[model samples]
Target chain A: MTDIRADIHAQTGASEPGFGDYVTLLKPRVMSLVVFTALVGLLVAPVALHPIEALAAVIFIALGAGASGALNMWWDADIDQVMRRTARRPIPAGKVEPGEALGLGLALSGIAVIMLGLATNLLAAGLLAFTIFFYAVIYSMWLKRATPQNIVIGGAAGAFPPMIGWAAVTGSVGIEAWLMFALIFMWTPPHFWALALFMKEDYSNARVPMLTVTHGRRSTRRHILAYTVLLVPVALAAGFTSIGGPVYLAAALVMNALFLHGAWAIWRRDEARAEADGYRTEKQVFRLSLYYLFVHFSALLVEAALRGTGAYALVGIAG
Target chain B: MSTRTTPLRPTHELHKRRFSRNLGVGLTLVAFIALVFGLTIAKVQGGGTLQAYDHTFRPALLPQDD
Candidate 1:
């Protein structure tokens, strides 16, 4: 026990971390995506919210997302230290103590849930609380180390933000909200799989059961193509929903075609070719996936804007 | 008994910085929480214009005009 404590203490350096390190522990990059998607969900809803109430809801939701990040970092610090991509994270870098992270996470979780409940509605608050628990306890603790399907099942936590946002505005979940959730859920696998293909060594060293580590690269490649094909229909289908407009349809069509091409390129590559080219196709697809989600969400926002200006009515797509 | 002088421990600046920053963060969070709670209370009381804000905040909570 003393040896283990010493090891942990060493990993969490004796030097005190600055404010920025604490922010890093919150996984700001991931939080940004959560914030954007949640905002889109809230804005695209038919109901309008007071500016202050909307601001509070978004802040609380962002805090809930950050809370999940801190807890995940606290729990995964050991493996994080072993993975090259994660080794420099605040906890693994010895900048923040694991205990501090856990405390911050729990505190923020409580505050976010209660505040969101007060600011929005009980339903939105409940969803936020569930999302935090799902990510921190279910995904981080249970699934991450247990199975190769971790990303597949765990993607639900990330997918909940937009649903929660919709709930915040409308005080209920709807088919449209579920469609947005499904979009993220389906996008996660191919996106993470692409990263895994390029960073298989990190997962191998950390002994995490990522698909690329458990199954061979060939299998992982095929999985990406399969998920991408499934994702295309969902993306296109969303363009026909109430939120859908010509802008979204055009964006979805072009993006899905490019996404399919990227996945196909990846599927056709062998380990030898991939290694020779430094996993270029896989890396390109991974980057494209980021833009893919952002563009889709942005198109939704554009449709919302057009609706606000009555252009959607004139276009007869305001349903 | 022979007396030996112990070296003075050096003060770490990083610790001081972290302490102040964390304090600031703690206070900010507390203030935000207080504000949210206050808004909630005002909402529950049906406080004038604020009640309209609450009504719009959750339209499902209000009676809908079919």
Candidate 2:
């Protein structure tokens, strides 16, 4: 890492991240969630969008999410350098200047909002703009350094993709859209806190004061289990919505059971045993959490297909 | 000669220009959103009125039963 940093310094008199480096600045994993949730929103909304417009809107929203990621990297560069998990990120690696990242983020934000408005409706475009600002300014700048409850609040930034997607199609928000947002919002804490349980040292090293750092590992573990308990019902409830079906219900049921079991095991394990387990339990839980989300969303698309084929009826029972 | 620190004139002007530019852009964004909202309201209201008239007068417009 040091050699790479030295090479970067030798090549450029000043650290100016290149185009590819800028692309890396937009964390691709986070971008994937934005893309997936937004796709689900577009797919399940009652209002049908023309294919071209839908495609354009989704792409622009993804770009807007990416803009937020870049802004986050720019702002967090200092602390990111200290975090082992984030030290290799472009800005932290000294390949990019903070100002450059800020500029890129702002430019992309403008392009995305304008393009989405042109391709779809102004309502969706406005929502996308707000989402970008919410993440870049509200969550990244304000919430992160100020409080350990950062992830809980900042999680909303990640939840906006589906809302933006729904707005793109319907040009309005609804209960169903909020339900989807709620699912992701509730799921974020458990997913992140589990990782934090196993990697407490990283947070300590970075001085970021993550939940595990502020509280104890046991508290973080209990929080993970608690959130997982809450997550299961929400995940399953989504299955009964207008967009859900037998396939999704089944997937949610099985995935949530497995997730709950994993969280339970993590919470119950002895500290020495957990350390001896070599992050296996937490890693497995994290991986399962990834699949859990994808499967649920995929099931929604499957249900849509079934309805389109006249194989199944779309129905919403009274709540 | 005595060295004295004075505020940079160009820097002050740059900040002022930036401030004005941001203000203009922000206002433009707000106006655009308001216009769009107005248009959406108009479309929905027009659609509703049209639907109501169509439903109410459909029988009158049809050929009479013998």
Candidate 3:
């Protein structure tokens, strides 16, 4: 069966976009975060999964996350065009048609959810569906333009992967799963707020009503400090869970202390001082926040590994 | 008889992109098929054995008198 569209464009060549543009619409960086967190969730669960099943579960989870990203790109194409950071996206940059993105997003969403249900369990599949809906419809369509607390609420969509991953293994959610969810949920405001501080002009220009846009930068700074202060307890409390051990406690303590210091520094600064330094402190906090979550999750992974080998038992912290 | 010429000229850039797109879709489909096949095999073997309506005289699994 020949493609009539391709045949029509054959001779003169309409410069049809290549497949990589489709991949770009998936937002690979954000997909990496979803993959990592979900992988950690699956690996650290109490029950051991066959390696092949685990890999398949993670792949479907990632595809589900990517589908959500594509849907987000489809829905937010207008604002994506307006913002400098997202101006070159496939739809906005004219590489791919908006309808193409919407079709692909929808198709992939169905495929990922169905495949995940087949590969794992219905609960994980259902959660992926909800995550997709939350990001595409709830967050992108409604909350983003509706209010300043957008990311605070939208962060739940991102936070669901670990819970889904945990469910994939155990067939149900648990306290530890919620703890992981809380880690990302509490960390999101402080993390994105730092980026909003540095990228303040971008949000306001797009009229997305980021905390910095609706609330003043002073208030945004205060919110960042407040969230950071609140995030510390959640981050540290994971250390006492089944996933945590001495390694996690140590990492959480040091990282949370630095995080608090960074937040406090941002809180103390005035607009002129921040502008003079090119928002260096804000940028540093943002960078540290990236490492903060990765380090915490990695520490949890390490504790899980040590526990598996009875290393924690020697130190009297074993299950 | 009109000669059957290829619709897409080799020299055209769109032809190249079209080729790339087709190849990408082909590879992705193949990978998906492979993954599904592998998953089926893995699930059947490692996902626990399927208990049919009746196996080869499994007296232990048969319903007992009350």
Model 3 TM-score on chain A: 0.95
lDDT of 2 by residue, A1-319 (tens): 1454444347654544344566687787888889888988998887677665677778789889999899989998888888888999988887777888899899989988998887778988998898899898998888877777888888888888888899898889888788788888888888888778777788888777688888878888888899899988888887888777788899889989999999998888767887887978988998888887788788878877777667763354221
Error of 3 at B59 (Å): 8.4
lDDT of 2: 0.79
- CAPRI rating of model 2: incorrect
* Model 3 global lDDT (CA atoms, 0 to 1): 0.89
lDDT score at residue B61, model 2, on the 0-100 scale: 45
For residue A74, model 1's alpha carbon misses the true position, in angstroms, by: 1.1
lDDT string, candidate 1, A74-167, tens digits: 9999999999999999988987889999999999999999989988899999999999999999999999999999999999999999999999
Which regions in candidate 2 have their CA more than 4 angstroms from the true location?
A1-11, A14-16, A313-319, B1-66
In model 3, what lDDT does residue A113 have?
A: 92
Which ten residues in a row are the worst by lDDT in model 1 chain A? A1-10
- On lDDT, the stronger of 1 and 2 is 1
lDDT of 3 by residue, A162-261 (tens): 9999999999999899999999999999999999999977998999999998889999999999999999989988888888878899999999999999
Error of 3 at A266 (Å): 0.5
